[model samples]
Target chain A: MKKLPEWHRIRIIDNPVIRQALVIAGIIYLFWSMSSLDIDWVRVGKGFPRAANILAHMFPPDFSRWQLLLRGTIESVQMALAASFFGMILAIPVGICGATNLAPKPIYLAARAVIILSRTFHEIIIAIFFVKIFGFGPVAGVLTLTVASTSFISKMLAEDIENMPSGQLEAVRATGAGFFQFLNYCISPQALPRYLGVSIYRLDANIRHSTVVGIVGAGGIGQVLAASFSRYDYDFSMAILLTIMSLVFLGEFFSNWVRSQLR
Target chain B: MSIILKITDLTKTYPTGTKALEGVSFTVDKPQVVAIIGPSGAGKSTLIRCINRLVEASSGEVLLGNTDILSLNSRQLRRARRQMGMIFQEYNLVERLTVMENLLSGRLGYVGFWTSYRRKFSKKDFADAFELLERVGLSGYQNTRADALSGGERQRVGISRALMQQPDLLLVDEPTASLDPKTSRQIMRLIVELAHERGMPALVNIHDVGLAQAFCDRIIGLTAGKIVFDGSTRQITEQVLTDIYGEEDWSSTIRKIEEENEVGAE
Candidate 1:
């Protein structure tokens, strides 16, 4: 047989020794973290039966306080609706200002800062803050989800606007269309569908977050669930949980239908 | 023939330090179609875009029917732009909009923001749009989304959209660059026909010498961001092609135009 030429595959990290050292460090860190956790096997063994006992008590959900449950659920839905409506309205200008291709440097920076600040904190943390200011009601939930949804919708919308094809916009500009006219005629037609789809998705997400905000005393189904837990009313809490799950399921279905129609 | 467009020493140096055009000047006094033929990166696109101030000239004047387009403020520029229609290589239709909406968008300059937003265009604008659509051979495609059309059909829509503006000057940048040879010829024919029919001056940047010679009344050749040849179509020879596009087998390029002329004459 003829002599074969040697071949070597290129690697992402070209330095073999450094690559090996990094891999070794990763493995060691993984093991160290695992060992550092105080895993009490005896406590874990007891937790299963305790959990099973809770599950047993959770069954046969009580419908005696159905009116209270319905009111709380309705409050959550209203919070979600208000949040989605306000968030969508606020997101338009913020999203347009944030798009690097559209806005000047200062405006782009300001809009981006708003987006980053809104995104930095978790929705529950925001809900806690709003609850502090708004004094325990669905107002806090609405405000909290509004901030969350605005950030999300604005960020996604800015990205979509930045990525749009410039040809259509250029053609519109060539027609001597004013800035706002160009926006309505060309940019709107291109960005509207995606914007609406993202808004609907944010609305669905807000529905789920509405229940969580109530745990912080922001007033929703979660507040009632927390009360039921405190009172040892596990059956009622179970019913509330089921209601939340169904609300989320219905929201997902509606969002999916709307998105499909948009497409 | 009166002075329609008089470009004086137009120049464009991109931020990246590329000199796309240098002291390029031209005059189009008649309602005739002029073709700009050049190699890639020879400032053909930059030159045409400069006439409408689309690509801002570094320091120069573009006189469109006695108005110094380069000196206009943004508001004045928007008003000035209404006189010049532009066609693009990619058609540039808002793909999500229906064909009628795309066509009516040309009237965006004449209408108010809220009026255009509500899509309540004037009846005359709608009538003109329908007529332009019929002229472009896409009469019944008003309800179709722009994305659904073929390339040629989209170009037709693009042409009509520009025409809907009632522009006095037509600026075409590689209008048929994306089309096949036959479709390109058809589009070129349509553009030239429309320009003559409306008595509008047109400046077309084309790559195909044969098509340019066949349709355009005059030819302007560019090389290295400078105008090398400017005369009637019959004035272009193999030597001129060599001067514009560098040395190659000029015989075939020149022969193709001759064959086209023969076919055209017959």
Candidate 2:
């Protein structure tokens, strides 16, 4: 072969550190895969037929329970809206606490811990716990979604705060603006647009999650869907699924409108 | 005249082991434009930042009027800072905020939080902001968002904002560094003229030597974290420039002089 140029001849694999790290990662992955005991191809294959049958029965949806569907959907919308509003309101301070630039080390760490704890479990899992405490209603769904929204919104808001232009903050601080004044003049103005963007995006996600939290008896459309499914009324389940899809699409359209207004 | 600002043996060392300022000391008499000139990394930024306590001095006494600002608690420091107004090289106006809002931001130190939150400035503050905008030659641009303005216009707004504070002292760090020669001179002229109007002592850090000489009452030159030249503009000779910036070709003097003439015209 003809000689390659010096730049091309310089091999990336010549770096000993990267080569060693890749080797170690490969070895660990191989060992972990080999140590796994269960590989159930036959069970999954056997379950596919039942899934197909259920799916087939789910078609030609019956809209017999329109009143029940409407009530549950409205409840789910309320849960999502309440959770998003309260979550965003609470996130203002918590986000400031979590921002490395705004808070002291200990406060930032503690706020980060709060965010982590909130997001550690899925909203459904949180709904299960809240349902146990509050005994199954929109309250359980709202509270669960609230925690989930706060974690996501606060974390993202903190990141936006942290990433803001330091020059603007410095200029504001130099004017001798107090803590909240600095936030209002410097931090809030810059971060408001981005915060609104994130909150709207999170609201869309919360709407989807709120509809399903009812499956665990937290109270929403999912509860009705679960009941219909259990009773083998696949047609009603299909109707509920269509309604959920429509709600999601509506939520998306509303969020899009809000974003357009922000611009 | 009262000393508006007194810095005695100020020093700042960063966490990364960079000595930004070392035993720097200066004082500003009331109602004078004192310019600090130096090459990059010679503590010009650190010195100016130290004055407002934005970049805290590791060791120093920053006495503003009678209060030792370094000794003040956070609340007191904030109060003291209100009396001081700062402008930046990049104009640092909140991009999304209207020019009127940015101008009113200077009064944030005095107003209640809810006042700013509601964006309800006092009538006097609004009237003053409008007057300052007119004085700064930005009469019709109040509702314009800051990002929409040109560089010179933005700096004009910056000066208006600082003046809105009715500050006792003004600190400008490289206000003209990002601007063209003509715009730089315009900004320097505005800063100098405004400081004189308010009878507020001003400390300006600048990279351009001629602009400082043309606009400042006194020029303080720093090199390697120490003041090498502190004298009236007429007293600054080629020897002083050589001492502060080290040896460069003397032929550049004519270019600088021509640049100054062109800038002064604008």
Each prediction's DockQ against the real complex: 0.81, 0.75
The deviation in Å at residue A79 for candidate 1 is 1.0
Cα misplacement distance, residue A11 of candidate 2 (Å): 10
Error of 1 at A177 (Å): 0.8
Top lDDT: which candidate number?
Answer: 1
Chain B TM-score (each prediction, in order): 0.97, 0.94
Model 1, A1-263: lDDT tens digits are: 99999998999999999999999999999989878997788999999999898789889988789999999999999999999999999999999999987899999999999999999999999989988898998988899999998999999989998998988878999888998888788778889999999999988998898998899899989899888999989888899999999999999999999999997
- Top candidate on TM-score is 1
User: What is the TM-score (0 to 1) of candidate 2?
Assistant: 0.90
Q: Please write out the lDDT profile of model 2 over residues B140-165, one tens digit for every residue.
A: 99999999999999999888888888
The C-alpha local distance difference test score for the whole of candidate 2 amounts to 0.88
Off by over 4 Å in 2: A1-52, B254-266
